[model samples]
Target: MKLLTLRLTQNMHARSSLLALALCVGATSGEGALGIFEDHADIGATRRAGSAEYHAATQAYTVSGGGENMWFTNDAFHFVWKRVSGDVTLAADISFPTAGGNAHRKACLLIRQSLEPESAYADAVVHGDGLTSLQYRETRNARTYEIQSGVSGPKRLRIEKRGKYVSMSIAAEGEPLH
Candidate 1:
């Protein structure tokens, strides 16, 4: 599959989880009824409300929100998710609708243990500035960590989970995922 994973081995943390895509959510989540996603939410506090809109013609989901960050032991962002058991993978071609916003703004394909900001999770993320990386937390409330990709400005970010391992891959413009 093209949309998929991380260098962090199975030893990092071993727990099953549900997957999410940042493209769409209700309580603070279910409102993001965009195509494939069943629910959505704003994880953690934010300065303003966030939203997910699906464009049928273009088959794209536009998700926007504000948060302090998705780092450390907590995360703040709009989460478009569906809970499922077993291994899963998700991929997205991320782009900021407008330019010159927070360089750290991230669009991610995520798998979270729970909706809480402190949930254990894994993601393939691309920042506003085109930095792509694989990020994850080992356990609930654990510190988040990542391994940056040497390649930047990729057109697609993919995340995958298999057993206790998670990994990520990217494809640059006109290039295949490695």
Candidate 2:
């Protein structure tokens, strides 16, 4: 899956609110029509809110939003998801439209229990500052932690989950998965 191009500017507060409104009304309805992701899910109830839009021609999704953080005991970002059990693999090409957003801003491939803000989950994330890591919450409302990767600013990322194990991989633009 190819995800959104976050274009964060100086007006973060206004943009966040607008993103939420747009996601609530436009994300699901129009997004699926353009075949971005199979479905959408909300988790953690974000403070600033976010949205997702799909561009059919490019086969990419443009997602935007703001949150205090996706750490500690809870998270606050928009999620695009589909239900599955057992083992699964997710891959995506991600990028930002501009270079001026929050350094901690992220695009991720996430797997979680439910829509609860503090639900147990694991994800492979690429941060705005080019840090890539595997972040997870062991249990509901648990403190969030991460195991950082050596790679940074990868253009593609992948996450795989099998039973209790989760793994992440990254690659540069136009390169093979590592």
Local lDDT at 89 for model 2: 72
Candidate 2 runs further than 4 Å off: 1-11, 14-31, 34-38
Instruction: Assess each prediction's global lDDT (C-alpha) against the native.
Output: 0.64, 0.64
Pairs in clash, predicted candidate 2: 4-62, 44-117
- Residue lDDT tens for model 2, 20-47: 1111111233446525355554455655
Deviation of model 2 at 42, angstroms: 4.5
Q: Mind giving the per-residue lDDT tens digits that candidate 1 earns over 1-178?
A: 3322211011112121112373212112322446567767778765555666666555576665655567799877667777776666666666655555556666778878888989888888877677888888999999999999998767777676778998887887556666
The TM-score between candidate 2 and the true structure equals 0.79
The positional error of residue 154 in candidate 1, measured at the CA in angstroms, is 0.8
Collision count for each candidate, in order: 19, 2
- In candidate 1 the C-alpha lDDT for residue 153 amounts to 67
Q: Give the TM-score of candidate 1.
A: 0.80
